[model samples]
Target: MAVARLGTVVLDCPDPLALAAFYAEIIGGKAEETEEGWVELTGHEGTPLAFQKSPGYVPPRWPAEDGSQQFHLDLTVEDLDAAETRVLALGAKAVDAGDPVRTWRVYTDIAGHPFCLCAC
Candidate 1:
């Protein structure tokens, strides 16, 4: 039997409350408490962001020799420049780019997760 198909993407964060606010701003919405320090953002409806609390959670030092991350997130936007601006405004730090800042640009979230902003 096929299990019920439900839910979308959910990001893991050490601080749900803080991460919730961060994503809420970038995703353009508010985050609701799902369980104590754990916050959920279903404001996007189809897409749900689940935050798990880990008191000792330490953000990875991405693009550095500190820690190695197993994965990352990528978002597509109509305009790369505009999207970069928006994400930066939401507290995303620009990681690095090749020569030109076109096509795609990598950025690290408040939690130090590397994500890409690509032109669609």
Candidate 2:
């Protein structure tokens, strides 16, 4: 048997360009086109961020309050306040995630996939 390592996390989006822009700005990179509905950002250091178009894309409803949170991204951070502030400014929604918020806050991306910022 051979060992393996972590790769990229791909989240479907409505518009690759637009979603790429949101991620590029938030992560500090540039999106390079591959096709009509596909683009990639190549400055992520370890792995490239990729986006694909889904015309029928419907943002995740998040929480039973609206719909439901199907999945989420957990990001490790050094400072909770700083990370939350930055993501919040960048349009991430802050919902009640009490226990998790003690060390991290769960926020939704522009597409509504929940992501967590925690002490790294």
TM-score of each: 0.77, 0.77
Error of 1 at 21 (Å): 2.0
Task: Say which candidate scores most in TM-score.
Answer: 1
Please give the CA lDDT of all the candidate structures.
0.74, 0.74
lDDT of 1 at 42: 62
Task: Give the 10-residue window scoring lowest on summed lDDT in candidate 1.
Answer: 41-50
C-alpha root-mean-square deviation, each candidate? 2.8, 3.0
* Regions more than 4 Å wrong, model 1: 1-8, 64-68
Task: Report residue 90 deviation for candidate 2 (angstroms).
Answer: 1.2
- What is candidate 2's lDDT per residue for 61-115, written digit by digit as tens? 6575865577776777777887778888888888755675487677777776677
Q: Please give the clash total of every predicted structure, in order.
A: 0, 0
